[model samples]
Target: MGRMKSSNRKKIIGALGDPRIKPYLEASGGNEKDALALYRWSVELTASIQETLGVTEVLLRNSIDVQLRKWNNEQLGHSASWLLESPASPLRSMTKSKRKEALRRAEKSATCRSASHFRHGQAVTHDDVLAHTMFGMWKDILPNHSPGADPEKTENKNRMTLWEDAVKNAFPCAEDPEGEKTYWRVAHLHELRNRVSHMDSLLNVDVLDVTRDAFALVGSIDPVLANWLTGTSTVSAVYGKRPE
Candidate 1:
């Protein structure tokens, strides 16, 4: 067998960090070349996962955004500020403190870009509102009303207002039943999204499961979107190439 290069082995160790890459190296019987190969494979797999995840996030966010806008308009008219602050709106069901926090976040997100455009003497469009607002903020405003239930229910008479209504309209399916399951899945994906955005290592994660979950979430929203993502995805191909 060819000897492993010291410089290449050192580079792999440094790039992936000790705790993560150490076990693989030990399992390879100190075969630096084999360990380095594993490291490279992991990097490639992570990249593929990140790429697929980005597409899934965009689709999920857009689906939710469209539904929210439709529901809000139907329920309380189309005033953006009223949607965020009206006593009859979803934000009303939240505790006073949570409502305040949510409003602050919504206002901050809504204005940040428009403020920039105003300063630059540029026209800001309605698209800017959609672009600047984040998926996490939407998740935050729609808290789980029935925290304890069989499959977890989004319908609660006590909390019947805009939040529950919006969830019903947004998810509205047998796959997620009450929408709690969908909410939970999106929450999990959001956490994973954060890690990927921050450039954190996903070596310890089950990349296949993450990929499956992402596709499933998109599938739940729109099967056609999921199919499109699957056709373009490199996750499965990259995962197949992992070192044995």
Candidate 2:
């Protein structure tokens, strides 16, 4: 056995048995040498292309994101990242500016509409968006709710509380522990929006983290988004599926 393994040519010939080579050979009607050569070319192409471009270019290679349950290659997954909501896509635009214009009329007419009707899941007056926004704001405020509440005595309020009308109007009282949790979440999102409005910085890593958690909050979290993000969901995903 040791003598058989000593030849370099024998070792190269041995590679013909690699599991990955069979499919390509079957698909292309070739022998082990042909399949192996093709594999080497694919490897070179992938590495060369990545070096020619940047890492950012490859970020979208993954298509089978389990989370959003859609091909990520088709659309970016919803992670608490800075998404600019398109007013025309039949899905919620991550864009705040766009959502605002769509929700303007809804302050008076509280009706929820389907994503297909709008430019994207955004309409001028969407009750669902409004309600979600309201919830999000209160959640953000939960961190510092109990600063000074005795209005009769006119106690000094926390500096954070006086930041804006949105802080004053949308946040829930520090007292509602159970309900406040939910409200604070909404408020934190509003705060993030505020940060964006102020021309602050955003992080994609942080965005992915936020997306994971927010997905849970919205019941849309997918552990598979990473695979999709990595482009591992192509043909392999079908094989990954269990027998029906």
Candidate 3:
């Protein structure tokens, strides 16, 4: 809680490496103390953003999962989870690999935890794999838009069909007929999540804008949840504490 000593700051800067501290040091106009303070502030800000993103990720995943499950069952009958579908149907080549990887990791985790539902000799459940999936998996699974992309391509057509059949329902409050807006918003948050996960610099990032985007995305699915998330978020408070 006390101001860090100059010697202690020096040690921290050295440990953090010159490259890592360079942007902060520059922003502080060569003042090592101010730079170090900014670095600490950034760490706190990152933590706050991570916390908010955690909630958003879970909400996004669950909302999409519910729709996907319903759509999968409608298409393939009872007890059919889209996540368990083979390469021939939805999920296709693009996502099948990622799904397999996530499921493999989930199974290993369940085995390690000796999960109650994960019988030693039995296969892992959909919930287990879903819980283990990364944020990017959800983002990438959504339809994409490119100016030059051919609408007739198998992948593009499949993405559109999936959106029409299932993904669009994930956002009950949003109006994204073609899924473009949703994809762009999710993509922005996905990049921010990656930066935070990698412990990269946020000194130049418009973190407030990122927060707004996050809330907006959440609001699209459920305004009540968005209100709750925004009301409880610490991003604004952390942002206010930034070193001048």
Find the candidate with the highest TM-score and give its number. Answer: 3
Clashes of each: 0, 36, 0
lDDT of 2 by residue, 30-97 (tens): 55445445555444433322232222212211110121123222344443311223322322322245
| lDDT per residue (tens digit) for residues 150-224 in model 3 | 878888788888888888999989988999888888888999999999878999899899889889999999999
TM agreement with the true structure for every prediction: 0.68, 0.24, 0.90
Off by over 4 Å in 1: 1-4, 23-30, 74-76, 81-88, 92-126, 141-163, 198-201
lDDT of each: 0.62, 0.33, 0.85
- Model 2: residue 65 alpha-carbon error in angstroms: 30
Give one digit per residue, the lDDT tens place, for model 1 in 24-101. 687678777787787678677767777897787677657666665666566665545323444444444543454355
In candidate 3, which residue ranges exceed 4 Å CA deviation?
A: 1-5, 85-88, 114-123, 146-150
What is residue 21's positional error in candidate 2, in angstroms?
50
Ranking by lDDT: 3, 1, 2
